[model samples]
Target chain A: MDKKIKMRAEGVNFFYGRTQALKNVDILIHANQVTALIGPSGCGKSTFIRLFNRMNELVPDTSLSGNIYLDDLEINSAQIDPVEIRKRVGMVFQKPNPFPKSIFDNISYGLRVNGVRDANSIEERVEASLKKAAIWDEVKNRLNDSALKLSGGQQQRLCIARCLAVDTEVILFDEPCASLDPISTAKIEELILELKKDYTIVIVTHNMQQAARVSDYTGFFLLGELIEFGKTQDIFTAPQDKRTEAYITGRFG
Target chain B: MFTTLFFLGLIIFFVGVRGAKVISWEFLTQIPRCSMTQGGVAPAIVGTLYITLGAILFSLPLGVACAVYLCEYSPKGFMVNIIRISINNLAGVPSVVFGLFGLAVFVKFFGFGVSILSGSLTLGILALPLIISSTQEALLAVPQSIREASLSLGATKWETIKRIVLPAALPGILTGVILSIGRVAGETAPILFTAAAFYMRGYPKSVFSEVMALPYHIYALMTEGVHPDRQMAIAYGCSFILLFLVLSISGIAIIIRQKQRIQHG
Candidate 1:
């Protein structure tokens, strides 16, 4: 089967002041597929994902070298606005971070910022995005209630709905289920599978089985390096690198 | 904590007992007569209100803007540390020195004269450090995740600050403003050389008009008036009114914050 590349990172190196966070890494994310990055803590999976939407720029004294492209556009180029890049590539963080706003307003916040002004269209899109995230039925009755009042799982899904509201082509999930219960994590995994029909997805997780369960492609990161990248089944069953096999088999982090 | 509250209660009790008899409607609404031994402190009350309002008007927007620039826009480095140190030191500078600076700059250089504008400008400068530091803390208290969420949705830095950060930090900022209002309303030295008329008739007609203020009035009544006993009682009355004014302002801010908390939650 042939798959088109949605995003490509070529020889990317990231630095936080004097410390290196991501070192000489290269990967390709395919269209309409879920790519899972798995590693122990501080293995640079989160750092690598943030490069896609230029979130690293917000951190002072942090620098990056190399090319990251969305389609054919060099997203890191000086001419490309981070705001414009973020419109195309959205993100969901590990902890559920809904703005301290109403449930309806939380979803509409993205649309409003992206210049969706019509009240009717905003309401429709908010409804549609909520439905897509599998959270509409739970929150529809209390749309005006504060988003913070929702359970952790619902808030996470609402964040996903917020990302979806902006019509982003790619959605990056940085341990989206890290703070969730088992049931919530399962619901999110199911939702990610459902979402792969339209949006390209990249998820960073500490759980190896989660990567295997939800991803088409999987990359194993070890100490700021991409040790192996292949189809999820092949990476789990036949890792090309020794480090990948050891980490997957729980020999050591 | 008990000792602190005891002393606070004692001071309130002393002031209220000494001045409660003189705090009638006429005493609050009428101008002083017979060398300030009689009549009301209406002009002083009006002047304190105007000067406090003016200080807030000048400082609130500028202070919030400065804090946003420092916390959000400016890159953190040695220079930022230097700037922060300078601001902290500015807060430590004596109010009397600020009064002198106001005398030379606003009163002499700008020719604002010994007027309400000059006093307001001085008090505004006095309030800036408090407002800036508190606002910076408030901005910092807004979790970074919320900002990232907004930016990830294509909101610009300013947009995120305006919509997310500022609103989140507003309660804290208002608390700072309330504290500054109490400080500004009670300050005597900053207004001594810049404003605070020895005795004024009616009320201030404009910002350029010199006016009586409560603290300076109390000071003058206790030291300069002919009838010491009468003036001392009136001074206590002025102090009581000033305390009431500051508390009411803070009370309003507390009410606003409670409403905001309820709405956001």
Candidate 2:
């Protein structure tokens, strides 16, 4: 079977007020595949992923020279609205940020904001999204409770459900499990494995075990450049680059 | 703080005792008679209510909008810095200076005359700086994470502000409003030149008509009213009423801010 490309970046260079963060880099993301970017801190993995949704523009004095394609559409063009790009590409931050509202409202916020005004459809979608995030059974009894009252892992799952509620074609997770416990991290990893069958998933993780366990395609970034990227199995077992071998073998980050 | 509260307690006790004899249901509802020596200050109370409400109505939207622009939209530049400095300076300017400016602009130049319209406009200007600063603080108090989450969910900037930032900042905004109310209610200088009537019959029929207010009424009672003893007693009553109004507003604002802190904690 021929794998189709869902997103692509070409010669992307990013600068934050004259200091370059991402050097010239190129990568292709496949449809319905979990692509994990693994690197040390400040490797520009998160910055590169943010470019797909135009989130880097939120920072003042930041500039990008690149061509990022979301299924053949140049999302970086001035004519393309960032808001519309964000609708198609959703993101979950390192920290779970649930709104200070009820659980039901938190899940339905994205739907409501996207003009889903019908009550029955909103209710159905909220339930469906909660189930998709694998948090429905835990929270079904207390839909009206404040989301802040939930545990850390539950809140992260709720954030996932929120992203799913928007019907995004691509989901970006920036260190989603960085704050979770072992059990919660396992649960989130399982959810990510299941989710990639329907939506393209791109996650940035410091945990190599998480990348190896959940991702199909893995990209190893070293100091703002893509050093190696291929099938997760091939990169983990037979890394083509010495740096990828050294970093994956616990020699250095 | 203890020392100030002790002085405040003493003053309140003294005024409360002196004014107790004059204050009543009739004193509040009946119109002042015989140069305010016999009848109740109904018109003054009504006038103060109208003017304060008008000032809030005029300033709240303008103040909140200015705060939103300053906090959310304005780029950090020399122009924004200058605007912020001017706002702080405006807050420091004397109420008497604001009064003079209001008299020149709203009363004489704008042809509003010595009416509620002029007084409310003047009072609104006096309250603007305080309202803006407090509202900016309120908007700033909302966590940036909420804004990022909203925007990441594809909400427009205005939508994020309206749905997430504004809701989270509402209690703080209300606290600012309560404080502004206290300032507007107790202020005498601005209204004296722009809107205070020496005397008026019945309630003000329109914004163009002059109206009596509590602060200026107290001033008149002490300085120019007919009988010294009776006027002094009415002045105490008026002072007590004004003190009560300001204190209650402040009390409510403090309670709201405390509740908000505890909730966030």
Candidate 3:
């Protein structure tokens, strides 16, 4: 099936105290297409992504004026529970947070929390999710080992597997491989490419090549503004904006 | 210099061992009977257990509840700050001052009147500050990430605390309790004015019954026109038993803590 608009954000302005974190940001994330938000540190790429899942609400003294649509649901509405929104729009953190549990338990945690009681079903789902994360072969044997004992790369994959196990339709990653080694980063990049076939993926990263390599539609953000939003090939090769050109060409943030 | 220090330590070690050997197994099992001064300390042994157990039961719940309230529920406000400050000051007030307070409050007003109930209440108050401090430390040591992670996973705040936070902090809290037990086991001053009568020859039958702990027995046997050798022997035996009890409790606590840590880590 062709990619479709899975979620949308319209005319969103976000502030941390008096300082503006995001100017008017409008973007549409399509199903089964990896959209990477690329910018310098503190340029609102991460802040914009955090809006969709309401992770930004955790910050005290922060305010938002916007409308975020998760499929047909109004995610930004006061009536919606952020926790419920998070279940649908699963987030993988900057650091690999594997829950200090055994590998099997870490994957099953989301399912268990959502009241998935049948052991047989949980086992099958955990296995399928791990395979989707491309980590089942490496970790399947030591399923009972503590997640902390896994390598950083493995831990990141385990987190992806955790997100998948919850049966989320969309996945948000905030610098998911920023702390990993190049090899581990490459593995995660590969995993990301594989994941984009099934789930709507939104990622915020500082790495330009990663944005170039992994994304289908790329949104170039600068100074709390969306500078360019279009196909990745167009953004990387022939960006319309002068700022996007300067940024992708290794000039300045 | 090394030899001088070593020799002094050696002498002390040998002296302690000799005392322990002299105050051996027979001293532990037999109920204290002062042949003119109570050669054994069985009554003192029983009294110490009663007071210590009662004090622990009273203080543990109160202290932990206060700590959990402070850590989880209390906002940073004037009342909370004042209560915290008062607890800090209470810890610094002299034991003798606590003794006097116990005398005025429990002994005279409540009519507990030189009984284990009054003594236990006084000791519980003494141990409360220590328990609160340690429990606070333990609760703080639970990583904030764990709580955030739990909450993020759709677990209610109460569920997160019940399942994740409490089990993790349990070791530190137990360590604190065991340490307080050691201090409570050795206390004499506060109980002297509150519960310890002149000379309790046997174990107390009820909470209100006047009790004789090892420390009180030790104190009285040292004075009050008693037979010098037998009195001194009983004191030494009681001291040895008290030391063993404290050490054993601490040792067991450490072992359990280490086991839990290894299992978790």
Candidate 4:
């Protein structure tokens, strides 16, 4: 089976000032597929994912050389506004960071910022996004209550709903479940699986088991390089890189 | 510290007891007469309120904007570091020096004369560094992650600051403003050369009009008046009122800060 490429990174070398982080990295993210980047700490997995939305550029003295394409459009080009690129590619952080506002306002903030001025449309989109993120029933009655009042799991889901409200084509999860419990983690994993039918998803997880369970394509990253990339079954059963096999088999990180 | 509180309490107790004798409904409502030893300091009270309110009107927006620029927009470099240090140093400069500076700029150069406009502008400048530093600290207290979340949702830098950062920092900023009000209300130096009148016939009708103020009223009565005992009594009354105003402002700010801490926790 052949999958259409949604995002492609070619020879993407990233630097923080003079220190290089990603060197000669290349990967193809398939449309409507779950791609999991698994690696130990400081392996540049998070950095690699942030490149898609150009989030790294927000940091001063950071530079990237190479092409990151969202479909046929080169996202890293000077002509492309980073804000416009970010609108299409949404991101959820490692920790749940709901705005200090009402649940309804939190979800609608992205819509409002993107110039969705009609009140009815904003309300409908906020509800639909919450429902899609599997958090509507828990928060429907208290949509006006502060988002800070919600539990950790609910806040994470609310963050996801916030991302969904913007009508993004690709959603980036940066170790989203790192701060969650087993039940919340399971809920997130299930939601990611459900989401892959409609939206392209990229997740960076420290949990190898989570990658094996939820991802269609698995990329094992080690020390700023893509050690292996293939179908999850093959990567788990027959990894081409010895480092990937050793890391997966519990030999070393 | 206990000894310090003991003396402070002693001073407040004596002033409160003695000042209560003169503080009547008529005294608060009526204007001063007979070299300010007969009636009330009503004009002075009104002047203090106008000058303080004017100072806040001028300073709050200017200080908060400067703080937002420093915290949100200014790049971290040698220049920013120098700016931060300069602001801190501005806070430490003598209030009397600020008074002279205000006299030179607002009174002489701007031709505001010794009017409420000149006084308030001086007090506003005096309060500025305090407001900026405290506001910057408040903005910094907001987590960097919230900013990233807003940006990830494609909100512009100004949007995030206006919608999220500013609201989150408001309680702290308000606390700072209230504290600045307390300082501005009791300050004798800045208003001395710029705005305070030795004696005024009526309440100030405009910012350009000269006005009487509590601190300056008390100062004039105690030092320069003919009837020492009578003038000293009125001065004590003015001191009591000033103390009450400062303490209540501080009380409100403390309550607000406490509530914010509880809400955030």
In TM-score terms, which candidate is top?
4
Ranking by DockQ: 4, 2, 1, 3
Query: Clashes in model 2: which pairs?
Result: none
Residue by residue across A104-170, what tens digits does model 1's lDDT show? 9998889999899999999999999999999999999999998989999999999999999998999
Weakest lDDT window of 10 consecutive positions for candidate 4 chain A: A76-85
Candidate 3: tens digits of C-alpha lDDT, residues B97-196 = 7888889999999998888999998998999999999889988988876665555565556666766677678888998998889889888888999888
What does candidate 2 score on TM? 0.97
Interface RMSD of each: 1.3, 0.8, 2.4, 0.7
When sorted by lDDT, best at the front, the candidate numbers are 1, 4, 2, 3
lDDT of each: 0.93, 0.91, 0.84, 0.93
Model 1 segments beyond 4 Å from truth? B252-265
Better of 2 and 3 by lDDT: 2
RMSD of each: 1.9, 1.5, 3.7, 1.3
Give me the displacement of residue B150 in model 2, in angstroms.
1.2
Residue B239 of model 1 has an lDDT of: 92
Better of 1 and 2 by lDDT: 1
User: Mind giving the per-residue lDDT tens digits that candidate 4 earns over B157-205?
Assistant: 8999999899989999999999999999999999999999989888888
TM-score, each model? 0.95, 0.97, 0.85, 0.98
List residue ranges in candidate 2 displaced over 4 A: none
| DockQ: the better of candidates 1 and 3 | 1
Output the worst ten-in-a-row residue range by lDDT, candidate 3 chain B: B31-40
